[model samples]
Each structure stands twice: as C-alpha cells, then as structure tokens.
Target: MTRLNHQEKAKEFDKWISWKQEGNKDAETELIMRFLPLVTKVANRLAIGLPATVDKEDLISFGRFGLLDALQKFDHTRGLQFETYAMWRIRGAMIDGLRENDWIPRTVRDKAKKIEEAYTRLEQEKLRTPTDAEVCEYLGMTEKELQQVLYDTSLAAMVSIDEAVGEEDEQKTARHSYIVDEMTPRPESVAEAKSLKEVLSKCIDKLPEKERLVVSLFYFEELTLSEIADVMNLSPSRISQLHSKAIFRLRSALTRWKSQLL
Candidate 1:
C-alpha cells in the first residue's frame, strides 16, 4: 500500500472492479476467505449479552452475508477504510438477522427500559446530555451505585443501533436509521443525507468532553474499553460508564432531530 502511487491507486481500484464487479468467482472467494475472521470478530462483539439460545455460529453466518454485501457495494476508490465501513454493514446485517429471528432477549429489553425512558425524558427536558449526578438523582440512586448500574447495563444500551428497523412492508423508524449504504441513490436523498450527517455531527459535538472522547475512541478508532481507558487515563469501568451514557444521549438527540429531518 505504501508503494502505491496515485496512478497505482486507480489501477488497484480498476482491478477490484474487474474482479468484483465483472464476476470473477476466484476473487470473490479470496475476498471472503480473507475477511472471514473479520466477520467472526464482529459476530463476537455483537454476541455479547445475547442469550445462550442464540447460537454464536448463527451470528457469524449473518456477518458473512454482511461481508459479501460490503464487497459488492463498497467503493475502494473512495479511499475509506474497508474494515471501518464493513463494521457497520456487518453489524447491521447481524442485527437484521437477529430481529428476523426475534432474538432481542426480553430480559435485556426489561433491563434497559426504565433507564432508557428516564434518560430520554431528562435529555428532552434539559435539551442537553444530562450529568451522572442528575441522572442518578432522577433515578433515585447514588453515584457509586449508578456507576456500576451503567457499566452492567451498557450492553443493553449499546446494541440499539438501528434497532427499530421495520420490514419492507412496514414504515421505518427514520430516527434509528443511520446506516445508509446505497449505490447510485437519488440526488435529493444524497442532499438529505448530508444534512442529517451535519445534525449528527452537531449532536456529537454537544456531548460532554469525556463522553465525546469515549464515543470517538470506541466507534471511530474501534478500540476496546481497556484500550480506551489506557488512552484516556481512566479505568475501564469509567470508560464503560461514559460509553453507556454517550449512547443514551445520542439516541435521545436522534429522536429529537428526526422530527425536524422528516
């Protein structure tokens, strides 16, 4: 990759197009074989907090389809990181399959419900990310107690990306629909998407300093909780607390922004 000059980059993309777009079976197989581990990795991350009844192997299988979809649709010429982009596709596919199987454990739902509702309502009323103190007071808990609860409940909160995706026959929830990967979409849709991205950017900027950094390091850098803790000079449990809070705040912002976007 370091040896690739500008023209060589174009050549590389051309090769990808010929192999992937022009039906080179061998190339497709190689691509899948190379990225099979990535699928497994994504599956493992998503499989956290899932039910024992939900087979981990099934998650890997769903992620394989995500890898295939990404290979077909990804633009190597765009100069984006394939792993980062494919993570979204892989996760979306895994979540889609889980929903199809109705694998959303009711226990997770019940665990998240009271906290999510309280957080959402507070954010709406305050029009900003609520403080841990504020949230704890609202929920009738102390700081020490709330920290453990947030870390323990983080899994329930983290898996809500596009969790409300409706079927083709049903109306979709625009708020949760952030993963917009389409080839050759309409001009209006592209403009609208850019605007929505701007809104999301502003929302992230509005998060508390620590929560924003935690979000960036976790999602954009793909760092683990312990790694992020090392980077931020905080405990892994602290990082997790911030992560859970950030997700909840972002979801609340999306709900408020969706009304205007629609």
Candidate 2:
C-alpha cells in the first residue's frame, strides 16, 4: 500500500475508527493491516541487542497484542497520535512478555547489577566516566573476562533502564502521563522532561570517546552492537561492554540529579 500524507492518513484513520466503533469487522481488519508495519518496525529495533536465542517472530507476535490493545484503549479525543501511543504499547508489551518468560538468567542479572554498582562507586569517587580498563580493574577482572561478562549480561543491562521502578500499574500510568499526554502536557511535566533530556545529554557527552561513539551508533543510528563493533574494529563482546558501561554511568548520573532535585 502506498503511504498517505499526514492529513490524508488522519482522515482515512478517522473513517476506519468510526466504522470499527460501530462493529465493522472489515474496518477492524483494515486498521490491523495498516499498523502491521509499525509492529514489525518496533520489534526489529528492539531485537538488535537481544540474545540470538530470542526469536524475532516472537517479539512481533507479542507486539500484535500491544497494537490491538492500543487500538482499543487509545482516545482520539486526547489529541495524541495513534502511532505515538501504539509505539509505547508495543514496546512495553514485548518487554513485559520477555519478563514473563524470565529470559535473562539470574546470574546474568546479578553480574549486570555488579557492573552498575562498580560504575556508581567509581563515579562517586572520581566524578568522571570511568574508562573500560578502570571498570575492569574495579571489578577485579581482566579485559577479556569483562568482555565475556558483558556478553552474558547484555540483555539484562538493556532491560533494566526501562524496567518499572515501582508498582506496575502506577509505573505504567506515570510513564503514559509523562510521555503520552492528554492534548498538551502540564507545564510541570514539560519542564521535567526537558530537565531529563538535558541531564541525559550531558552525561552522554561526558562518556569516553569510543563509548560515546558506541552509544551514538546503537541508539541514534539504530545500529546493532555487532555492526558497531565492525565500525570500531572491536569484537561484539567489547561493544556490549562499552554499551553497558555507558548506560550505567547515565543511570547513575540521572539518579544523582534526581536526588539533588528533591
């Protein structure tokens, strides 16, 4: 199907939504067909750093539930675009499904926590982004051993930053209110979001050059860790270590910033 421009697409969607609201099965099917590409796009992007054992098709299958849920729950009256709302629902559903499956082993999660702890301690002590060598020394491991641990813990690290920090329902509601709002966001929420972006930018900018490049390529460029490894001429495991360390530093910085705000 040819893509419609925004105006044309919105009008078409309004028609389909109205028909579906009136129990039109054909309209519902059409909406599903139209959103399938979005489901696939989210799944593919998320699957990048996931372990090889995870099936991409499984993420897509999980994402369909999110799409349907978004279609049912989304309020056009809220003035939020379906695409924006559906993207979060889809990604959240996939992560929830992965958690349900307990895909990351307990040991890997422990190791990832240990790495984060090292980052926190070092940053508090030195007030700088610790180099990979420094982190390895802090962990009392060789560079090769650090790489192996990183490979084992990569999925755990990726999931932790986005994991809910409080009661599940409350976390979901807070995230939705913060990221997806009803028409215009409250001034306070807008200010909080701006502050968060500024803190995150400064933290990322302070990363070691190679680590910064890895973060840039993976998140901004949407490149896989292996692809970034190729670009940097390092092993994929090394790239994962850099990615993990970068996230740890950012999380620590953000935590400290939030504490200072209180």
Candidate 3:
C-alpha cells in the first residue's frame, strides 16, 4: 500500500470501512494490505527467542491469518480501535499456530505440569510459597534435575502464561488482558482493578530478592532470558528455572487474590 498523509489515511479508512461493511471484497483486501506491516511487527516481537527452526516468515503468515480473523470479527461501533483488538487476536493466533505445530514436546509439557503441580500443592500445604529446595523434595528431584526441568519447560512457559491461573476458562484469556484493560473499563471494574494492582504489587514485592529481580528484568525491562542470565552472572538455564519459580509464586498468589475478590 502506498503511504498516505494522516488526513488522507483517515479519509481512506472511512471509505474502506463503508465499502467493507457493504461487502466490498476489494476494500477488505486493501485494508489488509495497508495493515500488513502491523502483522509483521507483532510477528517479529513474538518470534524472539524462538528456535531457528521456527521460521519468522511462518509466524508472519500465521499472524496474517489472525489479522484476517480480527477484521472479520471486529466491531467498529463499539469504539474499540482496530489496532489494539487485532493485536490480541494476532498474537493469540500465532501462539495457537505454534501450538498446533506441536512446538512444545509432550515430555516438556509434562515436566512443566509436574513442576506447577508440585508448587501449587506444596504452597497450599505449607500455607506459603515453597522454597526451591522444598519443591525439589516434593517432586523427588535433585536441585540439578529441577533446574533441568525448568530449562526444558521454559519455552512452553514462554508460550503459555494461561497455565498460571489453573482454570481452563481463565486460561483462554491472556493474563495481561485479564488483570488489566487498556481500553475502556467500567468504573467499578477500574476500582476493583486498582485494588487488585495494589495486592499484586505487594505480592511481587514479597518475592525473594532474586526472583523479584528476575520478574522485574523480564517483564518490566523486557529482557530476554539470556540477557537476564548475563546480567545476573548465571547460566540461561538457571535464569529459566528462577523465572519458572517466580511465576509459580505469582500464579498462586493471584489465584488466591482472585478467589477473595469473588
């Protein structure tokens, strides 16, 4: 698509929206062409840290399909911006495509599950987040074995944040979308979210200093695991283990916090 000035693009968008709603297939195609760069941008962001075998082009292709889905389902009358809504669907689609391709091995998925279950169970029993040593004892694994499991499942963790919530329905929604909304939220929801944010902040602050640092660098600073490892003077695998442990703590805390809210 040719570049258009802001006013020209707005005018063109209005025309396209009218034609699209009137069932003009060409208008739809033009819209897709105009927004193709957005898909590429989202694809590149998601493609980070993926193995070389997972081609970036393939992710872009998958994201294009997602953008198409968003175009089909989007509601312009509701005041939701197309870019933001499409991003959610686009990322979800790319992740779903990866999943359909069996990007995570069954063994790795199983190990991730075991670790999450061990943490959940031990935390509930102990009435607090379990230590790495405690989790190792509960899972009958040496500290080394635990770290290996964490390393192997780290990619799966990267793909699936929903596992943190431990409910299928909740898992269907992105954790970020669930705990927060950038678009308009109802006034009551805003109040509830503010309170929840405070609770979450406290929970994060209470994490072991190392785990807190890992969470801060990864989520706040947007650092890759290897980058975090370099900063902490640890192996990437060790950082992955710490990342997994920290997630388990947050997941458990959030589950409890949500329950109380209900």
Best by lDDT: 2
- Candidates 1 and 3 compared: the better one by lDDT is 3
Task: Check candidate 3 and list the clashing pairs.
Answer: none
lDDT of 2 by residue, 64-147 (tens): 998998888776565656776787788878888888898888888889889888888888888877766888999999988887
Best by TM-score: 2
| Per-candidate TM-score against the hidden true structure | 0.69, 0.85, 0.73
Of candidates 2 and 1, the better by lDDT: 2
lDDT of 2: 0.73
Worst 10 residues of 3 by lDDT: 162-171
**Residue range 123-219, candidate 1, lDDT tens digits:** 7788777787888898898989877777666656666655543334222333333423332133545665666556667877988999889777765
* Winner of 2 and 3 under TM-score: 2
**What is the alpha-carbon lDDT of model 3 when measured against the actual structure?**
0.70
Please list the C-alpha lDDT of all candidates, in the order they appear: 0.68, 0.73, 0.70
Winner on TM-score between 1 and 2 is: 2
Candidate 3, 112-144: lDDT as tens digits: 778878877887898776888998899898988
